[model samples]
Target: MLKLSEYTHNQAQVESHYLYKSLCKWAAKQPHATFIVEAETERKLSYAQALAAVHELRKAFGPAPRRLLLALPSGIANALVWLSALTGGHQLIPFPAGARNEEKARIAHRYTPELLLTEQPEEAEGFGLAQARVMTLAACEALIKQAASLEAMEPLPGQVWLTTSGTTGEPKGVVLNEQQISWTAEQVRLSHQLTPQDHGLTVLPFFHVNAPVVSLCSSLLAGSTVVIARRFSRSHFWSWIKRYQVTWASIVPTIVAMLLETEKPAFLPGKLRFMRTGAAALPIPDLLTFEVRFGIPVIETYGLSEAASQVVANPLPPSKRKPGSAGRPVGISLRICQPRTDETADLCDVRAGETGEICIAGPSLIRAYQHNASATAFQDGWFRTGDLGYVDKDGYLFIKGRLREVIIRGGENIAPREIEEVLLSHPLVREAAAVGRPDPIYGEQVVAYVVVKTRWSTQLAQELHQYAAQRLSQPKVPVDFIALDTLPKNPTGKLERRLLRAREQARFTAQDVASHTA
Candidate 1:
């Protein structure tokens, strides 16, 4: 998570506005223009229809919440509510629909939302709220439809409250204002060269910042179209792209790997341009394999909830793109700074090609976490990204690993991503995550969790270790490789290093105790 700063002076001068108004304006100009479509049902909505639907949903919310909890599955209905909430001057807090009831209750209690909206009303009951307080998508749509009218209020830029991906630890709510959100969308539109003629397929969930700001909001802002899928289906991914004539899509590395694993299609989609992958460090082998297998370039991007969505991205075409780099800063000024030890102390910048904590200062960056400022550190107007990376001479950023995820073995810091990347290069390895285990002799030992295509065996493990050794330093090779059917990942497909470390500690402690007793 990045420690954000106050909005820049230029950001304050920027005309920060809501997407709802933009949608309405687009609807009036092009009533028949398609805005979104359901890939499975083929149900579609033009700009006019979508605006009307959003208005109807907005009218049903008797009174808007200071903060509204969105806990619906991915769909047009979910999008409508989100747009309505943003335009209606309500703070938005999105909850993952797949979360357990207890988890939902915990988040609900922490955020203390005035309204809980979901497609499944039964799920809202977990929050212990009255039924009347919980609104369903169908129920919101069932409201009486009045003539479509746009009511202008004193410009109150709505704030979008987001949670950290919680991939490595507990999630925290980050607050982003309208300027930040709008700037991010515009950056994505400009950086990707989006236009009204273009169409995007969105397989990412609506609850995340990338889906809304990058895929949906950016498309709408550019007067383009987006197709929303309920969930990512590797089998149907290519078919959806071809059917919708989707030019590009926002995706994660997990989906890319799955697509590579599936049998290649007879031919690529005619109109498909490229696939954008982010939210995790893309293994170089997978990136090259994906491009070779599909005949489409994989544009690696870098973003976080704190930055709204996009901070950097590989250019689409006619521009050189490094295989493993996240590309140059698109709409932000990035710097490599010595890791901050105190919030009040100023940190010096690292030289080019020097690995240090990545930091950023830009219009799109968030101002602060919802209510927790102590959790992050900001210095000299730059927010520490907590990610360890370096910039090449070409100004391309290469992420090494996360600050918290670094493995300190015998006082020498080893980036887990370097080890994971080496293991993933192996033909048999499908998924890989590296964690540090406590070692009395060396302080910590490197261990890897791998999901292999073939049956796990000691010989296979030895082969992987040898392969890693040839590429990585001797100290970087994993002491033990545990084969699992799958590695645990957060909903956004980010490897959960903390969980793996915890599991390793538990197992190691038990073994140590048993040996002492014996």
Candidate 2:
């Protein structure tokens, strides 16, 4: 995750504050605005009821651990508690409501919470429940049934904590204080000039700050209505856009591709003001197609969990909005820092047009992790963003790609060496380089370019898939396999994955082969 300092100086003045206080302030101002609505569900809340529920929650769980896990959908009740949890003096830890029952239990054990709020009581993982209370959506309503209950307390400054990708390597928890999150939201509101007339349709998981802080919080702060979808579905994307009159939304490249591949919705929603893509680079093709179809600007952005990053965004109004350039530093400054040999030495910034590691420091950025002392994101004051991008003479920042040597398959991370080592063990396989290729559903799926001495068979593909599936998660398994007669390498014999990927994809098309038959 990129640190906020690696980017700007405007961040130095960020004051200490808590998120709960922000909610209270917003609720005090506009208590009648609609906060959230779950798709297909009649259940929802106006800002007034949302404030009431949040106040009840604060009273129920007084000052305690600053971390709280919100295992609920992106509905009205969920949104209310989500704000309450963060503003109620806790970090909201959200997880995908997938089949991973044990993982939820594990998190409950790992981050002991003062409260574990969910819509399902029976779903609570076995451990960490004795002391931690279980309050479902129905129970939350019951609290109101008794009487108007409100909790009063000063907000816990520096209370926000969010998680980014950590499937295998040490899970790094990106910690940001309440003030940083609020400021970032405020900046977006000002920079974009968004107003209550806009209604945001947020489908990204709320656990991640991307959905909450970026899309939802920004909308609410502007008094704009927000329509929350529990999960993203390409089938219903445009329908929801039209249904809710969604003006703004943030999406990942993978979802954008899905929309492109699927039949264009009956009609593009006219109310969509803008769309932002982040969490990964927007594919060139997907970016162009989306705008052509929707007639809306497809803005791009750069952000990280730590440092409250939100480094840059597409330019607005009269300025020509570049399609690929993440645009100049929005609400922040970005510079590439060349690492020096000295351990304690400060890094130097590279000249514009020069390629180096992107370094950032800003008000939106955070200094450290929550209870995690092992994080090495900071150097001097700037945070090292493990991304390799360059700025043009126009001062526009364009990200080339990730500096992290991990394969992204379908928006999932898989260490390359892990797949390489596994494939090399096969008796017929000679060598391998696992790289990612663009896919409609998965953003990028793993493709292995291989050199083999023996004949390849479908059995081999199944065997490799099974091999990796047992040892690693499903996302790490290569969806596409390339078998080559010889290794195409440099004179020094280093395998050229870029060349191999081109060759492999070319052969598949040349052969006119349909997707590998089962």
Candidate 3:
């Protein structure tokens, strides 16, 4: 029978002892095991080679811990640094090689590390920034000829910091501790069923907790080979999967939708055993289409950076995979909280019928936002998820939508996801976005921006509006629809609603003036 896995962890394992030092624990038993297969060049690293490389660097780092920002290709060297950072006992900030100069500078300054680890180990010429002792992967390689016995250095192991996309504000660091990392990895391993036999593929950026902790750490701890993508490319996805024989991978909804289209998939490696998707709500229609084509399950899950990356993942058994739901809570307990004048209270069994804010509490949940003191807390020390959903009688959790996303019109509330989903059903629509524009009389107006498919024409827009009107209620039908070749998208490929809103407001203002003059 399935039950919540214990999250109990000993800090000594992931934190107190250096990262690479304990990596030796996992490696000693399987020194010859292959741990990495570089995605770009197909170079493989056995456990012994990986361990030896890290040991060489550990000796060079010397007594005092160095703040090493990991910068290398997504291959053996990259994998070695990651293990070395943890086991070798350095405070690690894994930097993405492809990050923009501005983003790189911003993050580097924020971490304030003493040393920068990169493939090109040199003092950068024009950074105009604080100088960190630059050490390249090449420099570390040269030191191998004159290595001395190096003891692992344990770090001041708290607070592994992560940053948000900063779409809202200058990204505040999301701090995590060693217990959080080790505990979260263990929970995710059991939740995702990651094991040595599982061939994992990672396209998510290592900078994010979802990829680093959930995908990378979870897989490695289970002794699985993770195929790391230097960067995520829709065109390269199928080829990488086929080449790596990836059994499991994680993706957001955008990539899944692209893969679901009726073109011949570039199935370079063939199909994965299953896909785990999260970070945003996935549309159900595309979800169904993807499952049918791939012949593998798309396991929708719920997670947050605050909660160590994963909370609820759909279990693997065919019977357990629900087409629309994000599946059940995995390695954690979920509850719906009844909103009160003062605070929200947990409704764990929630009668299996009503909607409420989906709140989760478990060892994986963050103690609190790194330094955000003004935060909402519900009963049992659970963070208010700001999301509304309910579990059905069958225990399948269905996310209605985010609380902030619900729109109000004529004193009635409407979910934009529902409207967007309906609009997306129109064959002429290639992509759709719904936003509430400020209105004088109605308080808020529902507006949609659409991208038409190549085969479709301007006439299809009218047909789509009519199509939505017939199926959806009056308030739900968009009052104004604008056609675009494409919508602004975020780095992760999710539609940038905040940008779309600015555009919508501009159009609305222009229309109002034109109407007044006419």
Candidate 4:
């Protein structure tokens, strides 16, 4: 058991607001309590040992409070470095460890951080950064082995710099203070009803905000244990859950689909409570099937990097969890508002059950993008999420799609998710994506790309077209059905509609050239 003091030097303190400070208090009360476990090596770090490691790594960072960029894989070393930087009062900028050299260099040049940390010394060359600014994880570990004197420094709350997914364009940086992170972590802890006995398994990449705030920080505030995996592995996923007796895991829809397509384990891990899915919408059919097949409930969630990860999540069993809804807002003020076209006009909230732009405001939300104070997303203290959704009379949120993603065929607007749901309901369709293609008569026409369970054929496309026509209106029906082995997705498993739209445009361009030449 760990004990946290009610007051620090006669001043009242909120334990959850400062994570590293709570960690130090936990170490003082119970030195040997388990805190983090490395899934690959089964390495356990007690509270006392974790604090010592943080201090040892801080020496390498020195006493300067500068921005530190970390480009390392998810593991014990990466966790320690992150803790070291945060507790030492340094700002953190995390880049994906598996990103291409071009991407790494682009981020490095864009942010111009004071220090760059990586796993290998040569990585600095690839990132186009000077070697003097680079610090390798191996070097940090060697320094820890030396066991130098520990320095006493006050735990200072600093900003955490993160970037958007860059799905539409270049990724923009998001700045979050420690207080915001603490608020979101507490929301996750309360939504899931986490306790000290709960054991969380983290499979999402550490570069993303989900892994750190949703998984690590939430578990820390709950006084629970967390097992960190390098990445999501379908082959080793179930085995790890059984081996560690994992109570819950945070995952994406891509992982959910992969698990359903693959074979199941010989026996289910009874200790596992549920799987939390977010970052992208999970088709309703897949969500129900996953629950029925595995005998485990799938909790659907909605979040983004701007909000520090989770905003809304379906409650656990016996709580009236809706199947396709992202549940209600947790610890935040959520409303649907008319899309802002005129900057001077007052923002108006939409009535319940009316589709509009989703907006959020709370302690967990970021004020503005880093280096982008004039960004239009922040208006009157509310962050416009750019997502189109509606709240039911009961308060459950139903996402339609992005405002930019809506297809306007002639005069009517169409939601891609509506067509996607109908396609996924077909027994033969395994995966589906809907996008708008340019048209001569109508402004834009609906096109669908699907991955079938069996071989593709001309008749199969016709069959799918017929199936959608029966379920959808004439204007909403897909004019073209394209067969694909797999739909394009981002690294985090979000469907890339922009790529599909580009493919359609190129196809039409080539066809026009052929017709003119002939």
What CA RMSD would you report for each candidate? 12.0, 5.9, 12.4, 13.0
- List candidate 1 stretches off by more than 4 Å: 1-14, 143-156, 165-168, 341-344, 405-518
lDDT of each model, Cα atoms only?
0.76, 0.67, 0.65, 0.77
Decoy 1 TM-score against native: 0.75
lDDT of each residue in 1-518, candidate 4, tens digit only:
10111100111123543778666767776767777888888988776777777777776787757778888888777777767776677888887664556456667777777788888877777667664388887876676555434334577776788866322333567887777777788888888988878889988778778888888888877778888999878889888889888999988776787788767788788888999988767778889988888888999988877888888888889888898898878777787888777656556877657898888887788888887787777888988887889887677888887655666554234668767878999999999888888664354689999999999999999999898877666766898999899999999998888899889888878888998999
Write down the TM-score of every candidate. 0.75, 0.78, 0.68, 0.75
How many residue pairs collide in each prediction? 0, 19, 10, 0
lDDT of 1 by residue, 1-518 (tens): 11122211122223556476677678888888999888787878788877777667666654554678888878787777767777666788887775655456666767778788877778788777563378786676455234265443333456678766322334566887767787888888887888888899888877778888898888888888989998889889989988888999988876777788888888677678889987766778888988898888899998877888888888887789999898878777788888767656576777667898888888777656667665555555667778889887777889987766666564344667657766888999999998888765344689999999999999999999888876665667899999988888899987777889899889889989999999
- Tens digit per residue, CA lDDT, model 3, 425-487: 887788898887866435468888888776455576678778888766566689878888888
lDDT string for model 2 (105-127, tens) is: 55676677656667677656543
Residue pairs in collision within model 3? 18-87, 19-86, 19-87, 20-86, 20-87, 20-88, 21-87, 121-136, 242-268, 242-269
Which candidate has the top score in TM-score?
A: 2
Candidate 4 has what TM-score?
A: 0.75
